[model samples]
Target: MEEFKDQAMEQKAQNTETEQEMEANFSDMEAQMGCKEFHPGDVVKGIVVKVSSDEVLVDIGYKSEGIIPAFELAFTKVDPFALLKVGDEVRAEVIKEDREGNIVLSRKNALFEEKIDLLEKAFENGETVTATVIDVVKGGLLVDVGMRGFVPASHIERGFVKDLNDYLKKTLDFKIIELNRGARKVILSRKALLEAEYQGQKESFWSSIQEGEVRKGTVKRLTDFGAFVDIGGCDGLLHVSEMGWGKVAKPSDVVAINDVIDVYVLKVDREKEKVSLSLKQLGPNPWEIADKKYIVGEIYPGMVMRTAAFGAFIQLEPGLEGLAHISQLAKFRVNKVEDILKAGQEIPVKVLEIDMEKKRISLSVKDAVDLQKPESEAEPASEEPVKEIAAAVEETKEIQAEDETETTQTTEFVSGNEE
Candidate 1:
């Protein structure tokens, strides 16, 4: 019985040494397998080991392979097999450890984090970022610039935008006007970039623009006094007075919005940053050859255009108007100019004087009528004949009335005597 106890003790010591050696070998194997401890929210890099429709398995130097769900592979729904394949590298964020001892990772979250860092840098540096417009929401547009970004309607263009749906699904450049990482809010402006570019063009335009230069322009808007035209990057005023050589009642009559036209640069005010443009100057000036076209003491057909307190304005032709003074409306005295001459009335007038320097022409309707008279009646009639004719007619009427009154008075006197 004693010999048996000694043999049993030796066997127990040998088994204990074998168990320690096995434990050391297991530790060495674990080290070889790269057993890294990962917790939730840890970012990791790995190579894609397996790609399936539902999930993508990545080797992240961990005991169990990292599992990325298909839904977590991107911000939007995507096919994992098409997006990733075996041996492709990827970055992911650790979400949690699953019950199967597998790591739950999110590739979308990792991409989002990286994009936020890049966007933050872009915002600080005033750099432009590209984004795809996804939806046209109320008051603005929703875009995906690696994340949800909003562009206000007012900041979408240099002017008012009537429709926001026109920008749907279109990719455009933007400047980050506001950013809040905590709230995950981002505000972008395409107008800011457009304005910056326009300002550069505007500076170049102002520097190179010269007076009397003809430029192609689009009518932007119309006001009571003029139309604002977009001549390249700058807006210039096309005044109503300069729209035509003839009278312009309204600016709309000359040019409509969006009409492309040629304009003459009349003047440039650099101090005020104002440009005066003209449309009529692109054509010939009728007043330049008025003296050659018209002669003094000659009769011409004219149409009454408008009347003033002083006289009536008659247009001999387009862009050529002369005033017929109230005293020269007719051969007879005129109480009111409108009584004799109406607007749009065609009449003949004689030019009495021409002042080419002042651009004034003195016209006479009475003189024209006198020239049209026969030579026998061409002599100037004296006022005495007119007064004598009126006086003699009044005397004859007075004598006939007096005779009737005397006959009635005599009849009354005779009737009284008989009584």
Candidate 2:
């Protein structure tokens, strides 16, 4: 009985030892199988393990493998095989796991985080990066790098940006001006970057430019007297008179906003950094050909074009007009000039005098008519009329005397025949 009892005790002890060992093995398997605590939106590093036709498997230090979609692995410049191979390390984001399964991950979110990180570095270094303007709102715009960034409307351009839609999808190189994570504020400036670059380029361009260099420019802004042009980076004025060799009634007539044109450098002021440009220099001077075309004492057929307080203007050619001055309109005295002449009247005029330096011509209308000579030389005509009347009276007296003589002879002959 003692030997049997001893054997039972030894078996029970062996069973206990086996149970303990099994429990230890189960605990170790559970620890190895459990995934790490990875929250959604957390960026993490991973390694590519299996590249399949459908998907690429990544081990992100998690118990289960992470699958990246084939479409998500697309890269244009470098071959996908070159950018990603088996055992390649990469960064990714922790998207929530399949609730039914283990944790899931994304490469796009990781790329976004990387972009933001790069942007932060650029901000610290005062560097610029190109971004697309996604939306326009009141007072500002939404620019997109990886995440959306705010660009105040005031900072959209060198001055004011009227049409915000014009910037949409247009990538602009910009700099980060302000950023805050807690308040969720990010401000960007394209003009600030532009201004700095413009200053440098303008200084270099203006240094090499002189007062007589002709260049091509675009009309940026217009005013009553002139238009402003962006020559290189600085703005220069193209005055109304400089716009054309002919008369420009207003600056808008010759130049329109955003019109690309060529202009001559009229004057350069280095101290003020101001340049004066002329558009007329791009063409021949109309006045240079005026003297050769028109001469004094010559007649020109013209039409009344404009009525002024001083006179009616007559246009002989397209931009050249002569003033048929108030004093030269009629032969007789006139109370009002308009009473004798009206606008749009076709009239023959003779150029009495021309002043090329003053850009004026004196014209006359009355001098173009024909007039009769004076009657002071008619003394012989009066004498001839009186002598003809005296001759007629003398001939009448001779006729009467001859008729009386013939009647008396007839009576004497009749008396002799009767005896």
Candidate 3:
């Protein structure tokens, strides 16, 4: 009976041990719960899930999406459609949770909180930043920084810009002159940045520049007296009289805005920061070589450029002209200069005079015509041989004079109308 009982207990124990050898893995089965709760003054990164005209929906690892009101999208007037798009990553501040458990957020406030720190440092360090001109407003342009920044009309460029509309939709660099974080106001100036950069460049340019150096420049502005050319960082006056070898009636006649041109550096004043430039000096002066090209008592072909009452201007070459007096136009008398010589008429002229100091030349048409005549038409060698021979005898007789004999002397021109 005891053995039977032992066998039964052992069998029961064996049965209990063999009954179950089962184990289930619970490592992956442990599920995580509870999302992080956001409160006011919290900044979080979120992805834009939906962009709308009035609001934007962003997923910021919350139970519900964050709602950003249109006004909260930017400090300035903004079109959310243009500013934000679907699936854009955004950094925002949690303003509050509404009664319905919806999260209200502000992108503008978050950007303000972050960029203000940077802008303050930038202002203190005199650093620069790039900004986009959003719209033209009263007295100036509105730019998109972290918040709205004001740039006055006078701060748009180095020079005055008449039309403010030109700055719209343009990106420009600016320097922060005034930053009032308490008042939430920021005043910027592009001119300040330009002036600073130009000062450095101007100094460098002046160091390397010397008189008589030829340089390339762009025509920047035009005035009645001259055009202003931008060489590097400085503007030089290019007067109308120095624009060309010929005549330049107006500055615009010689240069246009944005034209790249070569110019001679006439003078420079580093202390005053003034530069004088000349365009005509790049070429040789036409009057300098006049002696080599023109000679007295010679004939040259010329065109009657223009006629005046006193004389007719005959152009022997480009920019070289001589005056032909009305008396020299023809052998006989002329009542009107134009009747004898017309403008644009080509004729041969004798060079009678050349004044190097005054740059004047005298030409004669009659002399030139006479030179073209046949040798057969030439006059006798001596028109009055007896007069010449008597003059020689008198000169040699000289006061054989008063002592030898008294002689009566008479002079004549030896012409048919002699007097």
Error of 2 at 3 (Å): 18
TM-score, cand. 1: 0.61
Q: Which pairs in model 2 have colliding backbones?
A: 97-104
Who wins the TM-score comparison? 3
Sliding window of 10 residues with minimal summed lDDT for model 3 = 23-32
> Clash number for every model?
0, 1, 0
Better of 2 and 3 by TM-score: 3
Indicate the residue-level lDDT of 72 in model 3: 95
Q: Write the per-residue lDDT of candidate 3 for residues 211-327, one digit (tens) a residue.
A: 899999999999999999999978999998888766567988768999999989999898998999998898888778877767788667777888998889998775678999988
lDDT of 1 by residue, 1-419 (tens): 99999999999999999999999999888877876689998999999999999999999988878999998997666788789989999999999998888999999888889999999999999999999998888999999877789999999999999999999989999999999998878999999999999999899998999999999999999999999999987899999999998888999987999999999999999889999999999988887887776678766667789998788998877778999998886666655565556687666777887788999988887765531222233445444433432443355346546866997899999999999
Task: Give the lDDT of residue 108 in candidate 1.
Answer: 84
State the displacement of the C-alpha of residue 22, model 2, in Å, after optimal TM-score superposition: 5.6
TM-score of each: 0.61, 0.64, 0.68
What are the candidates' C-alpha RMSDs? 20.7, 23.6, 18.5
What is the number of residue pairs that collide in model 2? 1
Query: Native-vs-model 2 lDDT?
Result: 0.73
Candidate with top lDDT is 1
